[model samples]
Target: MEFKPDLAASNPSIDFTNELAQLLLFTGEVGVAIQQFSAYRGNLNNNFSFPSDIEEISQQPALDLMFLSDVISKVSGINRLIRGCIEINNYKELINYLNKTIELYKAYSRPNEQLKEALKGDPYKTFSNTYLKGFVDLDFAISILEAIISKCEQNNVGAKTA
Candidate 1:
């Protein structure tokens, strides 16, 4: 979807600076939480009970037990918070915060080498490494915010030149 610059007005009801700051802070907490989930492999039954689709049979990936990971839920909350902050008119500052958040995700999103290999084995043998990746979802949200910033910049520039 195209970014609507007009919709990027700052909402008097919301304190975007604080909101963005909180999102930035939560990224690290989420990263640590995900790291802790590595121990969950021992608790979850890695074996898939049944084949659901081609991705299951062909890709042979696990059921993405990450859904059970609290990190996913927390990340979703962060995404929602970020979405709310998108209405801020400070495109430059918003973009800066977003880029910083993206960097944090990039630093933490890589599944450990051991977990990566585990996810590749028999789909039925593992409970994770399949579908849900919260980082990707977070990245999509940041990308949308970046697009909106770009559009806002364009609109303002065009208006000044005209």
Candidate 2:
């Protein structure tokens, strides 16, 4: 989509700062959390059974290698999307990026049946952030972010509204 700087000027209610901030923070947290998940595995396979001794997994040599590693990786591309959206004011692209992120996250996280079972009720609980606990709401957040980007487009900011 082409950039529309005029829309940003027309619509001044865009909350890019907060959106970008949250995106950056969550992406970082998710990345770190994923790293910590490494400790839950053994260089080969991760023990996913319930009631299993977590200490055992953290003690082995190869397993101990990443004893405190995270399972999620940092999403730099999301940051790039945030920057792109704010810079070019490409609200459409921003939405596309956020949508892509949601897809990627689901695709990567859906396979672990053990993790899925563990997350039974709370689907969006990333690492330890439990305020919204079970109510992840990132799917909603992406929509909101898109709407904000759209508003930015309407306001006619210095950049394009994509």
Candidate 3:
């Protein structure tokens, strides 16, 4: 089903709640993807072995590439959810939730940056690194959440006009 924000609600609180619920759902999806990626990486590492046959040398499995693509897709979904939330009117409770999400994103940034730098040259190495996809997802989520928080603050200020 296509998720669309309720744009015509007369009550701003209900609208904000709906938007927040969508954000929370996507955030939970990211969390699940992170866990699944971690498990897949661990399994890949344990089973990985250099090919002894010449024919097999050129046929490496594309697990890392596939995982990276999955992560990008999920992050894009989160971005859409953030955009939906941005359409909702500002409320104090929504701002508080956004602040907490911003903090969570901040925590996800440090390791992501370090890993990106460390794996800069090779696509395989970069994508194969366990934390890269998770970090990239976090970074995207953080950027979108920050934008929503800034917009919400502006809306809050403009709403107080006499």
Model 1 / residue 42 / CA error / Å: 18
- lDDT by residue for model 1 over 1-162, one digit each (tens)? 455443335443222454445445545544543433344323433443333333422243223334224323544544443454455433444445545555544433454555446545332222233333433244444554455445545645211211
The model with the greater TM-score, 1 or 3, is 3
In candidate 3, list every pair of residues with a backbone clash.
none
Best-first order by TM-score: 2, 3, 1
- Candidate number with the higher lDDT (2 or 3): 3
Residue 22 of model 1: what lDDT? 47
- The Cα local distance difference test for each model comes to 0.41, 0.44, 0.46
lDDT for residue 130 in candidate 2, whole number 0-100: 38
Clashing pairs in 1: none
The residue-by-residue lDDT of candidate 2 on 32-97, one tens digit each, is: 433333544334344544223434323232332221122222245554555555555455665565
Residue 55 of candidate 1: its Cα lDDT?
44
Worst 10 residues of 2 by lDDT: 64-73
RMSD of candidate 2 to the truth, in angstroms, is: 10.2
Please give the clash total of every predicted structure, in order. Answer: 0, 31, 0
| Model 2 regions lying over 4 Å from their true place | 1-13, 34-74, 112-162
Highest TM-score model number = 2
Q: lDDT ranking from best to worst?
A: 3, 2, 1
